[model samples]
Target: MIAERLSLQLPHTKVDPRILSALVCGSALALLALKWTRQRRLQQKLEEARRKREHALMEMRTMSLQFKEQNPSVQLEAILSLPLTELVEKLREGSLSPESVLYTYMGKALEVTHEVNCLTDFLPECVAQLQDLKKQKQRGPLYSVPISIKEHYDYKGHNSSCGLAYFLGTLAQEDSVVVQVLKKQGAIPFVKTNVPQSMFNFDCSNPIFGQTLNPHNHKKTPGGSSGGEGALIGGGGAILGFGSDIAGSIRVPSSFCGICGIKPTEGRLSLCGISSPVYGIKSVHPAIGPMARDVDSLALCMKALLCDHMFHLDPTVPPIPFRDEVYCSTEPLRIGYYDTDGFTLLPPCMKRAVQETKKLLEKAGHTLIPFNPLRMEYVVGELFLKGLFPEGASALLEKFEGDLIDPNLKPQLSVYKLPQLLKRILAFFLRPVVPRIAGELKALCGIGSAKNLWKQHAAAEVYCQEFIAEWKKLRLDVVLCPVMGPAFNLGYLGKLVASGTYTVLYNILNFPAGVVPVTNVTEKDEEELRHYKGHYNDHWDKLIKKAAAGGVGLPVGVQCVALPWQEELCLRFMKEVETLTREKSRSTIGPRIEAL
Candidate 1:
């Protein structure tokens, strides 16, 4: 009774004024310190890079003057024009010397690097390496052959910076497995090419190296993360270039630049000593492959790499040697064709390119059966994206560590920065407007828990099984599909992220795929695309048409895909498609080939 009458009282507490002030000030100072350190290091590396470029440019000018005084037994034009296969033959037969070949390539590379800004690191020790090769008798398929590599591949003395300022000064202790194999085969990687900041964007630009312009048109992008490789090969600077593709990194540039590139099924090639922002992530693993002007050159590259040498170097890769018989087969093939994936309807130029190829293939006696589109929405929204950012995209952005991100990457970078409430509001509004893309963004724009990641893996396995079942039911030998094309204009990749459906599908399926040039963009294609309408709204409809404007003469290509580990067959089909496309373009009359 007495306690009730008194009533209960509680004391109010407060932190000491000095302690609160100290905690706030301490955090502010630490943040400022970290940011300042990052800025200083970034500036130093960039300055070093600038100095190096100036020196290299000076050397190039001197080299050009000297070339005029020397005599090349093979005409300079003819020597520079030869393919990898021919280059090797000439070198071995004594018709071409390593010095002459190297000099010719060096001169062209200098011209190209200036034009497209494609090279990141020119081989500084190349002169010494050349002298060693000259002194020591060399014997291999690629003896004295000049190769260009993507920036990520390891070289013993040089940094494989991969467009990251943080990795700038750290030299690799040893060469990558692929690089060792190339050297073993006597291929000389004279330079490394540029990539996007994260090695993720399709448009190639970074704070450290600036942007890589398209060789076809400076206004358009060359395409990436293999953008520089595409530009170098397309410009005739390098006969063959090495690049990696997890999601059209190899094929997009190949298609955009009017060249050939292949993304082999995962585990078919070694990936040791390669630098990446995300390591130990296999959900959608990046694969190293060759990019070249012609399919035969790519075949030669694969033939050289898929050997006993690399297998022994990286025991994780299966000891699978190149099968020449598969590539040389003459049997009539059962080929399936699809003009549109229904996920991202390719532009008229792309579809037309595919149609022309289908016509040629039909005339060649290969049965071109119609193949329906598979479950592509799941591939893009659920399987691929979830596997890629299973912990959510937040962790991926942590890679930058408050360093500068590329301007061209802002659209993608913005997605990760969006608050959950904001994303939901945007998604809700976009659902009725750009429904497809709305769903794609929502699925891809966050971190994932362990349970969600498990679900993603399970879904991918299920999708792969379903796709294989469809392939088996069709009894198809090879499938001809349209690659995401014609290349987008500069600065459009973020808006068209969903357009990569065609290329990324094969990657998710782990299918061996190749991109082959079929035709150039035409006035008709541009006109047809102008009137084209989508199931969605003007956001993409207007953007898509605008990207195709002024795109005449840009390269358009088709994708050829086969089951996993069927790379030999995939290349064989590519070779056939390439031959037919050439013949068709040469003569308006259909080109007849000996029955497959």
Candidate 2:
């Protein structure tokens, strides 16, 4: 009976400790195996993403080759060889029809887009617009003129993605104020160009569209976030393009791609209806302007956009029409120039451009005064960044969650991830030791509160006052400086902000600035770069080294800046520079070419 009871009880009893442990281990293994299978599936998905990117790149290259084959005459020099004023004059006098000009540009643009990846949105309606202009027998300054817009600006029935994938199908319900103005002036908007994700980085790359290459040299980047517009204009596909600059967006690409661009003062042109990730934060100002192959075209576009109706559309703008009197006069003016910012040493090509420009201005009887920037390091490093993203740019970056961040913007996001409290603690601790650098650090760490935001605004006002004071003391009308180092090779702009030293200062001051191509790369310029000694000992040094290493034969450009609301004066300076450069080239080539 005991044996029988033991057998029955054993059947009902729980397993021994080792057996129970074995069963639990088996179940856990099964779960882990299932998880491993899921993880493998995820890995496959990632591989598929990479394959898609590669396929897109290949398709783009193939299309570029086809474009080149179809239009062999569309060379970089060919695009920049003629002035836009002359082109427009010919079109007006019946030498070129609207359709002919539009087709030429469209063909070229189609070709360039394949190679450079410049277009994010293109409209077939442009063809119809040109056709209507041809039919109506009407013409204007930009009539039938093909213009490309950066993706940030709104156009009715188009996606103003601003290069963000999340906003992919979100089409605009109506045109931005500027877009309507451009249309009313008879400009045909053909293409919308690519930008950096969120328009935050100097390099242009986003999940929505890839990268744009410098037209002069494909190995180098066309600078951003207006990089696509810059490349399109530079490549001769479009006569004019529109770009916005809060920090070096217009100027950097203009410099890198060997084109002319203008950044007007804040509120000069209407910003109403423009789309951006960081909307509603107006602490730092972004002005819209024109980019083109020549300065005259830039001036013309500016005049057309700033007509009377535009000011009425946006009440915030001052009722300042294009001041033709300031631009048309040929009076000698006081110009200020500085070779280096006392922080990062400029590349040698840039130094030569400035030096050569000074010689030309002096010969023309203009007063060339040497002016050092008023504490640029303190301003850009400290104040500008602090005020730019007051609420810490979290919203802008969060939109890209799970997407691969551009290598150039990775460091920026890391800085953004730290707690605001820690950043403030660091700022307080370091304020007494190195106030300017500390301020810069605090800004980078996004430590500003409501009180801090107000303080930064006040600081900006003081800086602006100081800048005006210095200008008054020197009695200067315009300032000249290198836009950046020799155009950085494509794909390597992730390392430094030194290139922005020239343009960002103007942006911070809300001054009008323009870029004029002065010279192309030469053997001598390349040799000088081989032995460059940069002033700043940081990532700037590394950036300089990379730019110098293989950046031979690229174009170099310089900035010409005028006081706030002085767009007309800025164009005048640009014209002077252009004239001087052409005359010098002619003089040098005269005897050699004649003998040949």
Who wins the TM-score comparison? 1
Residues 34-113, model 1: lDDT tens digits = 88997898788888976776676577556654765666343668878887888889887778888788778878888888
Off by over 4 Å in 2: 1-82, 135-138, 419-440
How well does candidate 2 match the true structure in TM-score terms? 0.85
The backbone clash count of each candidate, in order, is 6, 4
Question: TM-score per candidate, in order?
Answer: 0.91, 0.85
lDDT of 2 by residue, 358-418 (tens): 9998998999999988887777755667667666667777776545566666766766776
Deviation (Å) of 20 in candidate 2 = 16
The segments of candidate 1 whose C-alpha lies over 4 angstroms from its true place after superposition are 1-38, 56-74, 135-138, 445-447, 589-596
Give candidates' CA RMSD values in order.
Answer: 5.5, 6.8
Error in Å for residue 430 of model 1: 2.9
Candidate topping lDDT: 1
